[model samples]
Every structure is written in C-alpha cells, then in structure tokens.
Target: MNNRDEPANAVPRRAVLAGLAVLAGAAACSGGPVGPRRLRIASSAGDLGAGLADLVNRHLRDVEASVVTPMASAGTVDLIARGEAEIGLSQTDLLGVDASVTALARVYDDLLHLVVPADHPITTVDDLRGRRVSVGETGSGTAVTAGRLLAAAGLTAGAYVRSERSLDNATAALTRGDLDAFFFSGGLPVARIRELSARTRIRIVDLSGWAGALRSTYSDVYVVRNVPTSTYQAPPSATIADATLLLASASLPDALAYDVTRLLLERRDVLAVAHPALEALDVRSAAATMPAPLHPGAARYYRSVKP
Candidate 1:
C-alpha cells in the first residue's frame, strides 16, 4: 500500500491542521462553531469497507462526525498518508513498514485461502506446480501476498499458467473447471467464497506449511490459523493469516483520535452485531502490529484503557 512516496513536508502540516480542527470542533459543540466535525474515512471495497460504513452510520453519526468512502485498499493507504482521509482500513501486510499511516486498532485476522474443488487431488502448494491458478487481481492486496507466498514456496511466476483476474472471475473459472485453484485473502464468510461453496464442492488448500518459509524469506506478518469446518462447510484447515487494522493519518487531531478509539473500544458490543468477526478484537494486542508508530492520540487512548 506504500508504493507511493510521501512528501517530506506533509507530516508537520497535518499535525498543525489536526490541532486547529480540534478547536473548531470544540467551538461547534459549544453552540457557536462551524460545520460538523467532518472526518473523511477511506476503506477497502468489500466487507471491511461495508462493515465500517455501517458502524459510522449507526454509531458515529453524532458522536464524532464522519463520512466513509470505499476504494482499493492500497489506494486508501495513499489517501491517508496524503491527508486526504483521516482514517482508513487495510491489511497490515499491505501497509508495510514505510507507509505513513498509523494503526489505531487491529480489527481482525484475514486468512490466505487457496481454494480448489474438493475432489481436485491437489493438496498442497507444491502440488500446484504446472497447474493453472489465479493468484488474484493485479495490484490487489491479495495479489501481493500471493506473489510472496509463491516465491517463498520456490515457485516462480512462470511455474504455472497464471491468471491475474479478479476473485469474481477466478471463482467463475474455478466453478467451470477452467482453473485448478485460486488464492484469496479476507476475513471469514466472504460472500463470493460462500456462494462458490454452495454452488459446488470446494476445499481450502492448507497453507500452514509455508508459514515458516514466509517468515524466513519476508517479514513475520503471516501466521498460521485454523479455519473451522463450520466456516464454509469444509474440513478444518490450516492457513496463513494477517491482521486487518484501522489506520489513522498523523494529521488527525489527537483529541479526535482519542474519541474515535474510545468509541470503538467502548462500543464493541454494538459493532459485533453487524459482523461477529469484530467480536474477536483483542484490545490487549491492538497495537502489536507496528506497521507504523501508533498515532499519539491513539496511544493515549490505549494507555487510558489498559488495566
């Protein structure tokens, strides 16, 4: 997500604006202020975006003031770094270490799903050699992971007949038997994956074996997670996982950031109703993924809530 370079002067300017924005918001609440305390939030295109949008509409409408715009996950990071959006949602791996976006909370874990028909015989990443496979769409967060995982497994780009199409297209190809398998990374209960499971028998190829290779070759952003058979009606399987984090721009005022963090942590029960995945939020480890330093305001909030 940090492929774009951030300008040197942007950070301090954002810091100043955040302070001013706080004063303006305070004045407004006192009955003599300006417009609503508007916050522009950017998020990914699927469940992550939709789920956050739902939270903002239902809970943050009056508490902190906000609006949400959905876009590619990488694009969202660029927006936050440039101060175009005060907040964003992205997979931790995509944010990398150099990205300016700071993580406020680790929302949930997203798993790498290598899906194939249940009867397809291929049981491991090694078995995918010489087979037609969809790695994910070009420039997608999932695509980045797919490439790294393949390289870690000693499979070059040309090792197989590669399809760099959208998950929708890949799902269609897999359903029609035109592709051997495909890769996807997302929280559980992905609609497309669920639809594919219902339409035909499918199984997620276990990827736990590649976790060590991933850590040794790259960063330790990946982990092994067991996908319950109840998730998609397949037998329990092990795979690699990465956290999805709520990111904030450094320019967002410390006060506003504090409020937002408090809201999310205090309102977990409300959020869990929309998506049970959110219920897994562990505040104790929310800031464990140091993709970037914790924003000062978020740090204050976490410290206040810590026992």
Candidate 2:
C-alpha cells in the first residue's frame, strides 16, 4: 500500500533543504561521490566521546559519521591532525599543542578525579609523595592534567612511584589494592567511578587549591569546580576542571563545518538522550573555545544565530 523511493528512515527533505542553502557548491567541488559525505569522529573507545560520535551518526543523516576510537584524547587530536578523522573530541588544554585542528563547540567539562580508597589516610596532594599512583595511560589527557597538578603540588617525578594504565585497568588495580591512588579526568557521574564506588568505598581527592596555579602556568582553560555529593555517593569535593571540545580538522570545508555546527545546536535535545553530559551543551557558551580558535564555519554558524 505504500510505495516510496527512499527508505523509511531517510533524512527528512526539510533537513536536506536546509543544508543545501549553505552547501550549494559542496557536491560539485568534492571530487568524491555525490552521496552523503563520510565523516570519521575520533575519540576514546568507551567514554563520552564515543557517545557523542553515536549521537552524530544517528542524527546527522546528511553526513555518514563513524566513530574512530584512538583510546585517548591526545590520540584523537593526532588522528584529526593526520587527516585520519574529520572530527574529534578532546580536552581544551590539549588544543594548544596542535594547530591543524579547530574547535566546533565547548561541549562540557571534565573534572579531575583523584580517586583513592575511602579508608586511606591520604587527604591531599602532598600525601601522594612516595605512594603508588597511576597518572593514566600514556598520551591521555588525564596524564597531562594529573602530571601538571602533581608538579604544581611540588611532587616531582621521583617523589612518587608512578605507573601508566588505562582507566579500567587503574580502577581494577585500585580495587585489588595494587595502587594507592589513580587519576582520571572525565565527566561527572563517570560510570566506571560510580560502579567502583558502589562495590568499594572510594574517595575523590580535592584539587581546588591548584586551580589558580594551573591557570597561571597554563591558561584559563583550567577552572575550579565541585563534583557534587550525589555523583558517587561521596562527599562533595572541588577539583580542577577542563572543557571538552568538539573539534574539526582545519582543512574541513566551511560549508560542512557550518552544517555540522548547526546540527549540533538544532538537535541537541535529541542527542542529550544518548549521554546526559550533552545536556551541558549550551549555544551561549559553545563558541568560547579559548586557546584553540573556532573553525571559521562554526564561527559563521554562531554569528548567523546571534540574537
């Protein structure tokens, strides 16, 4: 009884029409096939980054978005810089280290979680001296921020016994009492941390004191924020926070970038269902990607939407 040329799930015609206004010449100029543009979004394997990629893939039907997990925020940047991925999710602090990428939006904040056993006597960064800790896997954003925090606290390399392990590995090591503490930078209510806390009493160290020192040494990319008591059923604590940016390759076409930015803002409510962290995305602060300049296309979109 129903005969149609396109599939039932095909992108709505209105959405396609909306893109045509800005991307009129994209198809003509692109040497590749005229079909939907293929986009690879680089991110860590199983964190918010992957959730974001899935969100884009589901809603942005104009482009075929795929997730390319390099397992670390720094690796995501590397993939974008190398042209292996067109989009990436990374920490704002790492943006200054790469020039081949530009930001699309300041998606959300990742709080520094210095987790230790609740019963442990370590009360502050100073207590970590001569203790076993994991700074996160090599090339991870956690490693970069954790190292900075330790240095700011005057805990030099030789002051602590250090290991580099992924978040999952570190969580397991801590649960087994193999590690005295571990540092992980992620959105609040991190599933791994929450799950770990449910079974084992865990405490998140407060790093609010080092916020000013980090900003003085680095940039304003670091902010002091509180992880609420409900996050992991632990006492509320303050920590150094950094923005997580949705970035695009500098060479991305302006039209494509504009379309991507537009979709992100327009369909935010729908995307938020996949990950609550997306609920933090606000058009008001989306353009404020300091240190890393906004992509020209993204800037254009923001300007067009200005009231």
Candidate 3:
C-alpha cells in the first residue's frame, strides 16, 4: 500500500555506465586480477541501500565486486563489527570509536528533514508543541537522531505527541492528514520526498541553528549541511547532517582495502548516477574520517592520491 501513487524519476543508468568506463584505466593500473572478486557491503534497506547496491554492481563489474547484502545502516555496521561483512555504509553519528571497525572513507551526508503540511504553522523544530509527529520507527537510526535533535531544539520527550512509524507509513499518513509532521534522515532527493512534493504541498522545517551545539556536544558525527534550493524546487534550507562512512572490519587485508578505497574514489561520478547525493564525496577529504582508525591500505591509497 505504501507504493501507491508514488512518483519520481528512476536513477539514470546511461550516465552511470558512462562514468564507470572512466575507471577502467585506474583499475588496470592497480594490477587488477584477471577475474572480478566478490565484494560485499552493507547498507540500510531503503533508497540508500538499493541505490548503492546498484552503483556497486554496475561500476565494479570490471573489478568483479557487488553488494550482496541489504540491511539497515546500523545493522550494516554491526555486521562489520561481528566479522560477517567486510564493508558497510553507516551514519557517522551511529559509529563508536571502539567498534572493531576501520574507516575506509566518508562517502556522503545524510540531512535531517522535518516535513509538515505546507500550510502548517510550524516553522522550526521548537514549534511542534502538542503536535502529532512521527520521529521515525522506534529504535531506528532516524528515531535516535530525532531524539538528539528535539533535545537540542529545547523540545523534550513529552513536549509533543510522538509516534513510531516507517518512513513510508509516515509519508502515507502525512498525505492523508492523519499526522501533523514526520522526520526523515537520508541523502537528498529522497524518492518519497520528491513524490510527496509533486503530489502535495509540504514544508521542510529548518534545523540549522542547532548544528553548532550538536557538533560541539557530539563531535564525532554532526555537521551543518544545506539542502539545495533545487533539490525540492524551493528555497535552500539549512539542517544538521551526519557523514555517511564506508567501514571495514579491522582484519580486512590492506591490499583489498586499498583497492576498495581506490575504486570508490575513482568512480564517484558513477555513484552520482545512482544517487546524486554521492557527488559530495571529495578526493581532498577522502581521508577525513575519524574515531575509527583508517585501514592501512586505505591510508596508503589516500596518500598516493593526495596532492
């Protein structure tokens, strides 16, 4: 039922394939094996996971790697910690320094979106008093982040009518006017956001003022990010964000780590085809991850490419 009347553009495959061709030269330079090796990565089960899985399958076809698992971003990191997965994509805010995981690179940013009916009186997080809002599914990453954000915005647990629902259910409820607002934490151009935008009038509340406090209090994971005006055909909105990282088991071989990092850095353009949000990955900041130590192979690759 959640898929009913959804509207959005599918990811463009032609652009991604063209970008994938650009990496052949780089892969060859690494003395890639005669055959492709299976590569596994964990991503949450939603647009992020599906888009990433598609990007990896297409771009790494030559290298013979693909994402074989689809799970929540938090679960992805957990699997990495448990040694069941070699790599995983997760929100930086959710990661801890002690997790038996190594940073391969920071891939993209996930912005917090508080959406309400376009005509709703709420203009900021503090205005939700007595309003029914779905912070996100109980125990989900979105819910965890929503709690921190609400606290930072001076709204405590009981300040508003809080509910638990999946993003899809929340979107449906919003469309039906059953709820006052909902929260989504993900990269830009989320399909549901776009679909809702096109079908109904909605507003993305501003949450930028709390960024400094969030960063200061939770240094390892928070950042200030502006959602572009073009993303939803409206004025740009400022919000707090958390970097998304590619993590690996500390025991992963350095050579493989190097290859994975290089492959990602080299084919970022292709990734953009899967999700334009990934265009944010920068070579200059490829090594700018922390808490978790960088895998030696990733460290070597970053040094080689840094100007």
Candidate 4:
C-alpha cells in the first residue's frame, strides 16, 4: 500500500489543513488571541517523519493550537529552500548544500545496514574490499556515509569499491549476480530489509571494529551499531552494521522551532510511543548533533534544558 492506502485518521494534507483552518478562524474571531500557530511539516514516508508529526500533534494539541501536515515529496531540504513548507523532518546531510536551512533537532539515529546475500562469503568489513556495492542514490546521505565508511576501511571509492543508487534496484541486481552488497539507513524494524531478507538469504556486514575509524574520518558523534539478531529472520544471524539519521532544514519559524525543540525534549515519551527509534532522545543527547547546525530556537530551548 502506498500513501493512498493509509488507514483513515492518518494525517493527510487536506485533513490537517482543514483542521488548521478551523483553528485559524477561531483565533481570528477571538480578536487576535496570538492566532493559531500553524506550521507546515514535511518528510518522506517512513518512521521518522510520520512519527514526528504524530508526536508534534499530540504535544502541541493544546499549548499553541496547532496541526501537523505530513508530505511525501518536496523533501525537507527542498521544502525549506522553496519555502513551500515551514518545517522539514529529513536529514541534515541532504540539506548540507543549502545555507538557508538548519537542523531543528536530531529526532533519531539511523543504522546503515550493509546487506549482502546470506550465502555470500563476505562475513566482515574486510570482506567488502574490491567488491561491487550499491552505496545508494547519488546526492543521498546513504551514499555519502557509505563513502566515509569505505574510506575508514582504507578502501577508496570508485577504485576498490563500486556504488549504485537504491536498495530495490540493487537487490534486483544482486539477485541477478550483478552486485555484491547494498546500504540504507532508517529506523529499527525496517520493513524493506525484512522483505528483502525473507526473499533472499541476506546478512548485515559488521563495522563495530571500525567505530574509531568511522568517527575519526567523519564526526565523533556517530558510533557503530549492532544490528540485533532478533530484528531479522536470518536463522543464524549474519553481521552487524552502523548508521545514523538526522533532522534538517531551516524552515520553521524561530518561535515555532523553539517550541518544537522544547516539545521533543519534554514530551519525548509521547514521541517514543509512535516510534521506538526516538526513544533515545534525552536532555543529554538532544543537543548532540552534527553536519547541520541547530536552529536558533532549538538552541534556546536546549540552553534552557541544559541542566
């Protein structure tokens, strides 16, 4: 099921707009009661965007009288650049090219799962040397980080390594024996990975040993993560991997951005209910982010909560 097949009550543009309109009208009738602070939030389909929208809705339901509209296209960075939207729930890496955008918060971290055929003899990072690997789409965060990871292992991209665009396309090529591995970053319980794993014998490649190198090459904030054994259906398990996810764009109003940061810090438990990936957000970890700078509003909120 695509976006059209979502269950009722799922946040849609028209639906959220209608709600915001009503709130706006009420505020106008109330003679300028600070007005309904409506903010347009956008992101690609998956846990981070949807989960964050839901969290914002519930958290600000009464405080500022607001509504969150989730969009699939016109991604976060683009939204901020074009001003088509006010807030974006995407990665900073995608927005790195644009100076107008800044990160409001690091909603969750992503794990880059290096997936290879289960029967393949590539048991470790060292095995990926001189192999055909699909790094992900060009201009994508996945490929950018994939290059970094490969460099950390002393394998120079476009030389000892091969890269491609997507996992689906890569998976097809892998099945036909055209590619050795592929990479992606998302929340735990990734449906795409699970489906791919079921149809083919696949294993995640481990990078924990290269954690120090990964940090040294990139930023120290990113750490190697273990792809839990229970998460996938591989009989004996395959391998572990590391990845990261980030929030980007300088779209939201400084005031609204501040509120959003404050809301996440204060009501993260509410957010975690919708997506376990965000459960990691805490006062301490909330301020630690990289690649993109934090919104001024977010900085204010973080300063207030620094205790």
Q: Pick the candidate with the highest lDDT.
A: 2
Candidate 2 segments whose C-alpha is farther than 4 A from its true place: 1-33, 97-99
lDDT of 1 by residue, 1-307 (tens): 2224666545665677999999989988898834456677776555454555455556654433344554456666787877787887777777755456786788778889999999999999988999999988776778888889998888897889898877889999998889999999887766688889989989999999888888888767888999898888887899998887888887777987787777677777776665567777767877564666788888998888788
lDDT for model 2, on a 0 to 1 scale?
Answer: 0.85
Candidate 4 ranges with C-alpha deviation above 4 Å: 1-42, 45-47, 50-85, 89-102, 154-163, 172-178, 233-251, 262-275, 290-296, 299-307
By TM-score, the best candidate is 2
For model 3, how does the per-residue alpha-carbon lDDT over 158-209 read when each residue is reduced to its tens digit? Answer: 8999898888999999999899999988888777787888888877888888
Candidate 2: pairs in clash: none
Every candidate's CA RMSD: 13.8, 10.4, 17.5, 14.2
**TM-scores, all models, native as reference:** 0.80, 0.83, 0.79, 0.63
Model 2 over residues 47-106: C-alpha lDDT tens digits?
555555555677666677778888577887788888999988889888756678898998
Per-residue lDDT tens digits for candidate 4, residues 1-307, read: 3377787667877778999999989988988756455556565544455555666666665333222333322255666667655666654334445677776666666677788888898877678778887887765656766767777776777554576656678778887888888887666656677777778777777756666776666555556565676677664332223323334446566777787778767777776665666677776666765666777888888888777
What's the CA error at residue 99 for candidate 2, in Å?
5.1
Order of models, best TM-score first: 2, 1, 3, 4
Q: In angstroms, how far off is 59's CA in candidate 4?
A: 7.3
Clashing pairs in 4: 101-250, 102-250, 110-243, 110-244, 110-245, 112-243, 118-201, 137-165
